[model samples]
Target: MKSLATLRAVSAPALAFVAGFMHAWAIASPLGGQPVWWLQLMALTLLVILLDRCRSATAAAWLGSLFATCSIGGSVWWLYISLHVYGGLSSAMAGLSVLGLSGFLAVYYALAGAVFCRLRPRGPAFRSCLFAAVWLAADLLRATLLTGFPWGVGGYAHIDGPFSALAPWVGVYGIGAAAAFVSALLAAVLVRPAQICGAWQPLLVVVLVVVALGRSHEAQDLERAPAVSVTLLQANIAQEQKFESATGVRDALEWYATQLMAASTALVVAPETAIPLLPDQLPAGYLEKLRSHFATGQRAALIGIPMGRIVEGYTNSVVGLGPGADEYRYDKHHLVPFGEFVPPLFRWFTRMIKIPLGDFESGAVGQSSFQWSGNRFAPNICYEDLFGEELAARFRDKAYAPTVLVNVSNIAWFGNTVAIDQHLQISRMRAREFERPMLRATNTGATAVIDRFGRVTDLLPRHTRGALVAQVQGSKLITAYAWWLSRLGLWPFWVLVAAVLTVAGRASRE
Candidate 1:
């Protein structure tokens, strides 16, 4: 028989592996073209906490590091498919790049693990809360401090489930905290010596109550919004054809116009690069056609196209057409690293891989709002919506708050991978966090109208060319997340982290 110490040592790593696998599996299962299994994810997390309790600090730390590394590594695999199979990167190079990226991200997870082990509490309740706080702090650090990569947070896995309701109030970090809380609570229950079920029964009640309250709040919030009509057009253009052929642009614009003409929608939108023509170089005949259609009144158009000076290089922009077109020209601020503009160091590496629009420039910083039919529309083109702070900055002052959010994207670069779905989830959370309706127009897939509560009013399927029409509500009132906690619910969370660390330090000394 093995020594008790050996079993204890093995338990931590095994549990950590299970946790990492479950976290990755939960995230991938939904987006990997499989049915979502949330209960399984919860069980796995609980197992990790229980195992951590049995192991030494060193063993727990190692396990946590392993889990963190694997989780990030799995996500990098999806990113590889996006860059390689879809974005046209060389298969070998793309795989290598993604593995490298996964390795880099795994460092953050390792940090989280090391911290969790070092700060592991003596009391069960203290330990659980401390773990949640530390993990959230680590997640916040990951999203901030180096331009941030807020993708693949633990909370994102709960986007479509009952837990999603918490996003508006506490943002993504809150969801993660909730997940951690649940796992810790389960650990406490499972590891109990028995017959003490009555003592811990109140904890379960508290969890149920919190979840119930979250659901109730979501339902009420959903009912509050006054629906506004929106139409999103998706032109299923292939990646190779999008950047190369001018005819593809002409056809896409014509198709979108024809679709808009058939329906009497309030707002009509087309995806990024829907009109491949630059702003100053828009075809005269096409401009006239668009002008004539809007002259009839009561309709506005927002289409994504290439804009800015060719002398300084092109900027990926979303130009609002019709009356609003003259008032608002939203140039995308955040350019994709390798996709839009190449970093100086990586310039030499570009020869090994193929990247579309690898020579584009970034737009000016800060949010630009568009006024349309008695509403302020904020545009987040492509990857700009991923930056939570950037998105919240637009409505920092209530006077300049946008009535709705518009995201124009070309997700065709990622093909049919989970990246598209993951992108949609981020957008959904943003809408709920800001309590603003979001209209997403994309090339290829996931063209959708999202409500203030993050519910999808309507959506177009991936790889399909279609139009989605739905009534999206607009909000002027600032959400708690928008007015208070932008970007992983930062301020309060930081304060909490400081307090937790202080208490943990005192406990360690004692």
Candidate 2:
């Protein structure tokens, strides 16, 4: 038989590699729009536990760090694609930029690994619980601490799966915690001998129960609400050529108007800044033509445009056309960090990068809803969709919340990169968590309609120019998560983490 030392040394690196590989696949698989990769993560967790059984504390720590770093590094490949291929950055600069970002994010995983090694448990049950707690804490920190970039949370892997039902109760963070719990249980089962009836069996049972509850919640009788037929116009206009000529703007506007001018639509939507020119700057005849086509009482058009005043500076505003122009304007609230407004510290860096009309001011927070065809819609422009709580809370204070959630975006900047797909996935999760149907109209791709349950009913392909028309249903009411935020998951997770830490401390002391 091999010595304990030999087994420990061999297993540690192997387990680390497995963890890295699993994370890589989990992130890549989703971006590629493939099948779920939760099994890969579970397998890696099992391998880690098995290695932990034979390894010393120092070896375990090293292996754990390796696992964490590699897992996060998986996203770096996509980051490279975004910067180099999509963002127009040079090959050398893109490589450097992605490496820097990946290294920074990987540090959180390294810390998780260190904590896991320090809390080495004697019992299989204790070890598994501790692993779940430590990893979850690290994941939470990654999302919360420094303006929180919760981009690749493990729970997102199950976005379309049975576990997605948990979104309404625990939000994405809760789903993430559940994923960690399941992974730990898998680890426990693999590490412990078949005779050991430890926490693994009970934990597996709990996971199943939670999943069943999620499935039931997903299936819970949803009342069929009145549907609103919307026409989403995807004008795949290139940003570089958007402002080159006034004729280009007129041609694009005419194209959208022609496609959506039919009588069946209650409201017609356009992508962000579809009208490249300012409201007043458009050709006088073209503006008149739009007014004549959409002015009738039967239909109203909501078009995204850049509207500005000398007093207010330039703003990315979505204007409602048709009957009353003054009554309906939804300015973009959460502007992108560097794309829309230059950060105070990085203001000087703007000289290096070339972006058209980069400095734009943000709209007032909690602005009034955009009114269209008797429906008050809560508008989320671009990156605002990523802030789940902020978007959900916008509807809470009012007696009657907006009936629909409209996201007007220009994903052309990222081209056909995974950025658009990842963005759509998050939008799907938000729909389930908020229980609101989301209508997205983007410049390049993924202009689609998402139902209240997070299902993508219909979507236009990326890089193609076309119109996607669908009937979308509004929310029945605000979901449980809309009010609770992450509280439903945070309290329970912290309690478990504290208990695990207590046990770990005692074990270390002994």
Candidate 3:
């Protein structure tokens, strides 16, 4: 038999690498459109098994940190495409950048793992619940603290699985909690004979949930008769050429304006930063010519344009261009850390790449909802739809809650990778949470329409330039998840996590 020290040293790193590899594949598109979800469960199960193997709190924390850093860093390896392939950065710098960011983000998981080890209970079931609670807490911190970057949450893997049914009632984080719980239970069963009784528990859940959610809710439940007619414009504008006024800018303005004139839909929306320049910087009569055409129409056109001046700074904004132009305007709220504004101390790193427009002002959280054709439309520029709570807040005032969610994104920066599909999954999750329709208009890819049940009713091909016209539904009903989370944000879920750990501790003492 192997020595105890030999097993301890060899097992942790091997487990970390295996978990990381599985986690990385869990979000890739090769396995499936939504990635392989079983891989995610497998990874989480391995992680819990490793944590349980850890003899000390310090070892557990270190193992968690190692797994997270490797897994997260590997999963977001696509950043290399953004930096080395597109941003003109060296491969070394791109790799280091992804690793640095992943390492920084892993601290939250590390802390949670440490707490779990320190407060570990006796029963495997209770311990599993405690592990899940801590994992959810870690994910919550990842999404909320420091302006939040909630990428690669395990809940995303289950978008196509039984956990999908839980979205309408619990939101993304709650699903994540459930995922972690199942993983912990499976991990215990993998090693302990005591857990054998419940070893097949997760399988039973999968069978029941798949059957329960088999109905096509998006098709039968959502209103299709009175669908809000929308025309979404995707310019296929190249990121490198977006700002060169002579070539990219001139062509984009003409193409979009012509598309706008031809469109007959009630609402027409262009992709994020489709204009590629500040309104003031555009050649005189350029905007006017388009405005003149759209100025006298029943159809309304919304264009993504950079507005404002250098003294006060610019804003990544969307404005209504056709009839009733004064009614609709949306400024992006969730600014990307390095892409939008240089993180407080990270200015030096960003100097390597030249992004056309950086450091724009953030729009207020409770910004005005655009009203058109008896439908309330809430616009989220870029990946702002990734945050479910931010969208849930609109449901607080049920009277004015957004009936439709519109996402305008220019994910060209990330290149034509799984980021497009990942973002689509994010919007789909939002639909389930709010029971509202999501219409996305993106610059490079994933231009699609998702329904109240998180189903993509229509989709445009990735990396292609064209219009995706769809009749979308508008919802007034706030899901049970939305109603509770709207008021206190993530606190209710946080409280539940704390309560679980508290109970576990009490039981351990008893």
Candidate 4:
């Protein structure tokens, strides 16, 4: 009996670690394909099992923290490549930095576990609902506080699974909540048979969710325009040489200009910073020549260029260069910490690197989408596509909401890792949320067109220099997720969390 108890104790922690590690693997790409989503549910079930077995809130918190540490550490290990390879940080320091970030970020989940243990219900259904609500609150907080990093959330695992159908209706966090609820319900069924009767409520919620998704009007009877021809230029500019005036800058100018002048399409989009210079700073006659060429015809050129004068501060911006297009510019609203703009007191840390163009001003949020021949193009720069709520905010005014989405990125900083595929997942989620086609142009990779259903219809292989030519139809209908998020922000989610906890407390008392 003693040996049996010892074995149980040892296996629980081991399972916790395995669960976290498997969760990490489930979201990993090019290494673990999207179909490993089942592993995520299994991992969460194991974590819930561990939490349920713990005698105290503190123990549950520690277990949750351990699981999160393993998961996040595994998922973001590639950050070592970015910092050491590109940012010039020492390998030891870069590695320690990643470990430190994972440890710190895991606390959100730890807090959720701690809170759930303290106020858990005797009835498994209420407890499961409480767990789901608390888990979502943690995720929502992680994605909100300190500019938010919501990568590797469980909902992302469902990108190709049944939970995906909920994306257009509830967004990633909502999908994540549903996933957590289901995972906890599975744990309840396995660990505590007495509570099985409570399962019907969550099951009914699932039924309603499915019926709602089935009856969704987001994709029905929307105006479909004739496919527009788009040419995405992926110049494959090496990050180290992109700004050097000697060869890198000059070569990009010559190469991209040559391609643009040669192409005939309704819209021609270049990856972020393809111009590498502001409007007033372009080499003499270079900007004028491209403008002159694009002015004579129906073709329009939308390229990423730095915008603003020396005194006002420059923005990482994309400007429309051709005639009837020059007035429109989309400045990046979400600036990447350490990459675009160093956070307060972190300037000293940024000084350790040799990267250029690290300091940039932020653009106003909700700027008007660039109006193309009847279709509005909303542009988001690198890392901005990670925020679905920010993107959803643009849908409040449907009349002015973008019909097509455009994202331009320069992922060469991470260099030839799964970061490319992970970024592609982020874009696909956005495509589903708004039911809009995402047109992409990238400096290094993932240049493609995502249709309304978030499927990649056309793609250019990563680390290759090529242009992708494809036709895409615009979407006019706003999804249910977009409609709610644009108006309520994340208030509904917080309210749901509160309600679940309140009901769980009453059930436990009863």
Q: What is the C-alpha lDDT of each candidate?
A: 0.71, 0.69, 0.80, 0.84
For each predicted model, how many residue pairs clash, with residues at least 3 apart or on different chains?
0, 0, 0, 0
The model with the greater TM-score, 1 or 3, is 3
Ranking by TM-score: 4, 3, 1, 2
Among all windows of ten consecutive residues in candidate 4, which has the lowest summed lDDT? 28-37
| Candidates ranked by lDDT | 4, 3, 1, 2
Error of 1 at 313 (Å): 3.0
lDDT of 4 at 497: 92
Candidate 1 residues 228-297, lDDT tens each? 5778888898876765646666677678778867667777888888887666666668757776677567
- Model with the higher TM-score, candidate 2 or 3: 3
Put down candidate 4 lDDT per residue, 21-85, tens digits, no spaces.
Answer: 88887775546334366888899989998999988999899889889888888777778877888
Please report, as a residue range, the 10-residue window in candidate 2 with the lowest summed lDDT: 484-493
RMSD of 1: 3.5
Which tens-of-lDDT digit does each residue in 9-92 have in candidate 2?
676677677767576556436447532647545745764564455435555556655665566656435655545554567888
Q: What is the overall TM-score of model 3 with all chains considered together?
A: 0.92
TM-score of model 1 vs. true structure: 0.87
